[model samples]
Target: MPFRRRQLLALGALGAFAMQAQAAEPAAFPSKPVTFVVQQSPGSTGDLVARALGDALSRRWGVGVVVENKPGANGMLATSQVARAKPDGYTLLVSGSTPLAFNPHLYPNVPYDLRKDFSYIAPIQDAPFVLLASPRSKLTSYGQFVAAAQARPGELTYGSGGVGNSTHLVMEMVVEASKTTLRHIPFNGVGPAMLSTMTGDTDLMVSVLPSALGQIAGGKVVALAVSGKARVAQLPNVPSFEELGIQGPPTPGSLVLIGPARMPQPLVERINADVRVVQQEEALQAKFREFQTQIFSGPPSAGAGRFLREYEEWGAFIKARGIQAN
Candidate 1:
């Protein structure tokens, strides 16, 4: 054989051997421990859900799942970390609407692009925002809250996880629809923002249902209204914004699992399928119910589409309201 032909044949043989070797490697995903990066504080709803899902996944896969809380910069810290991580399915992000949908619109220079930087794995849950007033405050109902806001304008202060987060944006929508104004007090996370209302540091806040449930039950705060289309079962007495005559699309916050972009398609499908199975478990469902979370597990494409839709909706809303981060 000619020398060049022999060299080509040898290279082809080596390539075939490499492909066969790679195919023979273990097919089981999560061969090693998995890390879920969370963008909320330890006790926040996002953190709680991440830990719960991680525990369930660990049980299912027989591998350890770690929940890391890296809360700061309106969730940019953990989000950017996950966006830059290797797309090996080992490093994941348990993020809410903020990082994936709302932040790019709210910030002038977000580090990562939602469409280009991450792979949507699965949606975990969706919880409506609940308007809460300090138990000490006289604002006891949605009507009273609206009236007070209109009467006082910027005198009425509201606390939120942060500026540009779903918590803040939802409240802004409510205020706009009500034709009222409220001072925004941004905090590091829902836990701190809820605490601000409980301590009367802020007059009111619109927080995710799960994060505010404990406070509402303990009488530290009063449930004024929920931002869902209907009243939340956990707080039946609390009216929804629609029932209060406020009109707009429901502004529920969502939590989704994602990984760095360009992850293997098979790996994404496997993880998403497992998440759906875990979310449907009776025990997990009950646990999430107790926290006022409604499971929303679905296909990765659906999750991606929802994220994109929310990005456009929130971007328009923020611009219309002239909302800006502090």
Candidate 2:
């Protein structure tokens, strides 16, 4: 249900604020349609999650929620497009780890500023990455994997989406913490990287759970430890780095929804409230089974603060690690 004017008026300024939010707007706020700009390819985990949310929101609002996939230039094209959009909440950026938190440092000339450009809606989900090895490979356990990597430093190659991407950096953090070395192979995305590992072209792959779950269940890849503080419920037997007495920080996916910055406070609150509601629905919870993604719905204030902090931290992580695009 749309927010009642009476409830908004109870906040007093929020009612006046929401009314002004629609002023000086072309046509009306969302009078036409809303577009969700996803920086990932179609059928990707991030894209699928956004589509689900978009579908639900569209059904609720009686407006078309079209998802536009712009998967190039390391998400610069999509980020730039949305950064310049009107702050009327019609144009939302369905951002993943790369575009929002890690890109500004990787690219030489960024087209947009993450902190200055978007009003965060909520964190979509926080899934951890899984490390997989081929079934034929001798590296059976995490200890064996480490032994092989140590025996031939920079010999056991691992695939990631690209340098400075979450897959790459997380593994780098893993190797660095463990005082090990391996060859870092960069791919355009997780799909290709996982295929590389499956085909035996790469010895290791660090990828989000969704991209690797099918192969892991099919007995193609050896399910090694995950990069999380706790083991994923989906893969109950698979241990976590922390459980193994490993020392890396808790790593999780950074997918979140946002609009252009300076969006009206009331609009942000209204959307956040709706998302909090969406988070509680059984249908969406059932949908999470398909992807093994855990929803992390919260107010925009907490989500936005997370974005800001990670945006800065990733910038430093990128340069310090000397990760680069090929």
Candidate 3:
């Protein structure tokens, strides 16, 4: 054969060999345990989401899924820590809008650039808050609560997780929309804030529905209004802020799955697809409904842009209202 023909055959053989080698390689994701670093203490909404996802993923992938809580700095600590982690798809961050979207604006020095240093993998859920009035306050309806707050401008106290938490910022949205002045009593976490409101130490509180569902069902607190676009089935009697003709917060607090920067697109898509499958399981969907959270299902690409949009929306709201990470 001529030299040119021999060279062409050699190149073709090399291409075939390369394709075969690539086909022989096994999928690398979830070959070992995946650690989900939660940005809130155990039992918080973020932690709950992480644990639930971890369990489901563990069962699906036949590997252990560890949930590590590094709750501090309004989620900056865990978020930055995960951002600096290896982008091997083994270490991920399960966090809410506060840390993922709002922290960069609420805190003076966020350690990570959300757009540059993180891969938004999948959205776990959209957990809207329920506006609860202490039963002792005799505020049965959202209208009545607004009237009382309006009448007693700064006298009626509302509790929140902290100064810059979603709990606090969302209430500011309510305050702005309602044009009422309610004094803020910041607590260590939404749990304590809910407790304070239940005991009537605070007259009103806004909390993620999962944490406040038991109390609401037992009549410990009056569920005045929820923060999402529609009323949740669990709280059918209670109305949403939109239903009451009130402008609610820009977004209901969201839980998202994310990893360090530079994770392969295939890996991100794999995880996103697996999570959507897990979310569709009837048992898991029922559990989510019990928690009063709506599943946020989408492609990985969509989640990436969604975070940027939410970041801008919440950042503007935070800056305009002078919210601070106190």
Off by over 4 Å in 1: 1-26, 249-252
- Candidate 3 per-residue lDDT, tens place, 131-153, comes to 88998899999899889888888
Model 3 TM-score, 2 decimals: 0.91
Which pairs clash (backbone N, Cα, C closer than 3 Å) in model 1?
none
Kindly give the stretch of ten consecutive residues in candidate 2 with the minimal lDDT sum: 21-30
The candidate maximizing lDDT is 1
Higher-scoring candidate on TM-score, 2 or 3: 3
True lDDT of residue 115, candidate 2: 65
Over the stretch 1-326, how does candidate 1's per-residue lDDT look in tens digits?
Answer: 99999999999999999877654442677789999999887877888888888999999999999999998888899999999999988999998777767777777899999999999999998888888899767888888887888887799898887788777888888888889988888887777887889999999888778877888889999998888678878888888888987765447488889999988777788899999999988878888977778888789987887788888888888888887877
Q: What's the true lDDT of residue 112 in model 3?
A: 86
Instruction: Show the lowest summed lDDT stretch of 10 residues, model 1.
Output: 20-29
C-alpha lDDT of all candidate models, in order: 0.85, 0.78, 0.84
Steric clash pairs (candidate 3)? none
Superposition-based RMSD of candidate 2 using all C-alpha atoms, in angstroms: 6.5
